[model samples]
Target: MEVLGRDVVQEWECSRNVVPSAFDSHFHLDRSGRVLQVYSLERLIGHAEGPVPEVLVQVSDGVAVFCDPATYPEVYPCAPGFGSAVGLHPKKPHASVEGAVRLVEEELRKEGVVALGEIGLDWTTPEQEWPLQESMFVGLLELACPRRPVILHLRGQDRYSSEVSALSLRLMRENTSPTQRVHLHCFGGNLDQVLGWSTAFPRCYFNIAGSVAQFDEIQRAAVRRIPLNRLLVETDSPNRRVQRKWHNTQAYVGEVARKVAQIRQTTLDEILQASLENGRLLYNL
Candidate 1:
């Protein structure tokens, strides 16, 4: 099996241009079972239109999708196309941090759960919710270790500051080991913050989203500062839409790759190849 896997990976590497797909490090398929994005995988690969891409890692909130075991398989079945990351969302309701930690730990043991994530801090929530959020985040991080890689959904207190990032980093350092793989989802911090994270958590990765197209100089500078090997691309689909007509999808990941390549002064294919490998390494795919 190991030899066969190696052969398959070699084949993928050989035909770089015709690799058939690009990995989307993060995305969400509607829990309601509605396919919001118009583009299909077939359309993406066949036409090469509107930035062709594929869903490699589809991360859904554990509380939202894994509340019921029976529906969980039907809602998020792992197939040849993509894998799933099931973890608690910071915004999802939980009776307590202990319950959230127990639930996430159970879900991590399930088959097809590639990673633990869509977890972390969201500062937009009410001040009273902050305590619960921090406690839950710390609990999840503790349970995540000696297990799967984590996907963090960190949001700043407001547009001007990275207070949430600072708090999240502190909790992560306290709860998680330095070797534990972490991906900061839909990152929106400045270059200095990115540099600090890179220095503090060497195993950490940053994901670029379609929303980056609207970034100011600071955010774009952060993109430029991200090392190629520590970068991944995501759509955060059905949300973080780039434009009115576009419902973000894995197909739009190519747009993010393009933006990153531009910021790094490199080619799109180079960024795509590096990010593909980064996603595989981060998720152990």
Candidate 2:
């Protein structure tokens, strides 16, 4: 692919020989093992393989999800560059707690499986379902080993609710060890929440997604105040909607890193490099 009249792949290949490539720390795939984007980059745009210099991000490092159980055997063995996690997402109403636990336990034994989550509580669900969600979350937490990172998917009533945040912190503290590495996927917490999680688990890394561009004041403050070492970047690709039908891709992770750099008053390369290192450490990439 070419960007701005320059061949991006050639440049990426050359630069990658010298420095580490940028990592898209989180993304999702459908049961068919295809990236969950509305428009296929290769069909709509030009070749979608190259990472552009616009934000100096490169190829994927890891942290993509096979959201469906059936995709496990078919996808993981073939996908060489992706590190996956297997857990029931809190918002998935169709997933049964017992079945989810069994599936998670089975997948965690695989070599390609790197983390144990995108699991937690979603306050937007009916209050009666909270116990079910908590039950699955606690069961998955029991399977979390300190050797692998635990990626959390947390949501509240709105962008500002602390109810889910506080509850998640409490649950994690009680269920998981302080030494367990944690990945807070698509983090949008306030500074106080950041402090709360960091105080409890110093190894926790907060992931800032492409939605960083839409963050409110408190969310942006949390990003700015986040420790440099604890910072990570993700595309959460195919999950971010740019328009009515168009969805973002792994390339958007670079854009997120750019916004993070601007927010932290640091260089773009610094953010990208830090994220690459942090992701490698967290996911054992």
Candidate 3:
């Protein structure tokens, strides 16, 4: 609920409380339910249990909050975060696509609104919903300004099927401009497929999340193949907890950076610095 501005962040640092410049590229600040009551970002990051992470200074520092159009009214007055991406969830499409598009347009006009997304296909849902999801995904992509990057959420029926990724890439290729920047959020696919995506969409980048700690060999290999400059890290906080007993927060991006470093046979600081620079570039912060 708290958003720190540049001056406030500087003040905290001046007091000897160092705030790492790491970014949690994707997360939700507007979610509700028991998770909020029992767990918090502060506790997860080793700070006192509280509403927000103590060391997690500013969302604007390196975070990109996603605004779900389906819950726009409730999550509106979007938190004072660094940047935001607005889109309709494929699983929970808006009651009216036209209305949702209008809302997205409005959000894009706001300050710190950097991308159009968390919008893509989810094949795990019933087959009956595929058409609607595709339509909405295409609609949102068309609505996005060529200059704005797009965050994508692509999931297959299960970890085994690559169809969803293939189809999503095809749709993006056909619907979006070649110059548009695309981020494949929480990427879980294999190396070959991702290399294909990189070749097909040279402007696209891939994000690594805390759940990456649980990645199998294939997924780890894919992470290794990602060009460092094209790699970004996130917590997907209040979600994608690395463990059931732990609360996920932006602070945990360090853990993801560590994992990436290990996979790429590099140092943690190297990956951290690279990811930080990559995030600032990707969000144009």
Candidate 4:
């Protein structure tokens, strides 16, 4: 597809004449799995099927239920459906715990929807509303305990992480199984914090985002303590950071690959190999 006048993403090393079988651990594909609107899932799949690459996609729901109509059915049916998570996003009408539980219950039952979150309390979200966020998270746990894999979005400093940990502990208490694979997407924590969380929960998986490309904390010490098999990469696309583009994209997934390789002192191909395996391991794809 011809990228028009907007800040078109120039093709990078990730899309270069790379070999097939390499996987991008995390990416926010349009529900339809199209890129630049010009490149449809049909196109991407076509390229991926070629000898150069075979990408496993993890389609996400930002804040709204974009899957109401399965914006990704075109590609969903054609590939391994990696499913999506849901919650009362920051911009949406905040649902109370009861209401959020009801929504999560419905989301978990959807055909390709395999998980129950992208949910957490953000400190900057509003003080008075925190109770509701906490309740919703608790409710999500109630509704999704059977479906243990969850995507997390935590904002703020240590307080946020601590609160999140506390909430998680509460959920863990009620969990029937000890295998909740919780993914902290674009978590803003230092290495010590990441290690702490890793040591805290056996199922905790720290997701590396674009900021890892340059941030010393994320790129260095923190990534070291975590086992590569337990690590995953993501591009919380459309969500910007202080480190780079305010929003993220699939292209950034490449940067994620790069950063992971750099941190592990390995090659990008090695990063791809492990990331792909981790995706299957964590998401059960």
Candidate 2 segments whose C-alpha is farther than 4 A from its true place: 1-20, 31-56, 73-81, 93-96, 241-245
Per-residue lDDT of candidate 2, residues 1-285 (tens digit):
453322244545566655436777887645212543323222211113333434554554767665456545543532445577776678774367677888778888877788887788888888999998888888778888789888888888878558888888899999889998888988988999889889999998999887787888888899998888999988676665222133555645667888888888888889988998888878777
Output the TM-score of candidate 3: 0.82
TM-scores, all models, native as reference: 0.79, 0.84, 0.82, 0.71
Give the distance in Å from residue 41's predicted Cα in candidate 1 to where it truly belongs: 9.2
Q: Write the per-residue lDDT of candidate 4 for residues 1-285, one digit (tens) a residue.
A: 222223222333354444424333334445323433323322332222112111323222111113222332332322453444454443233436566567557656656555555666666766776677666566666755534566666665453366655555555556525566777766546566666656556677777777676656543676766677777766554333223523344433545666667777887767666666776666666
Q: Which candidate, 3 or 4, has the higher lDDT?
A: 3
Ten residues in a row with the worst lDDT in model 3? Answer: 41-50
How many times do residue backbones clash in model 4? 8
Residue-level lDDT of model 1, residues 43-107, one tens digit each, is 22222122223322222111112322233453344545356777777778479778777876777
The local distance difference test score of each candidate is 0.65, 0.72, 0.68, 0.51
Clashing residue pairs in candidate 4 are 19-52, 20-52, 20-53, 31-71, 31-72, 238-248, 240-246, 240-247
Ranking by TM-score: 2, 3, 1, 4
Please state every model's RMSD to the true fold in angstroms. Answer: 7.9, 4.3, 5.5, 6.3
Better of 1 and 4 by lDDT: 1
Per-residue lDDT of 273 in model 4: 63
Comparison by TM-score, 1 against 4, better one: 1
Model 4 gets an lDDT of: 0.51
Point out where model 1 deviates above 4 Å.
Answer: 1-20, 35-75
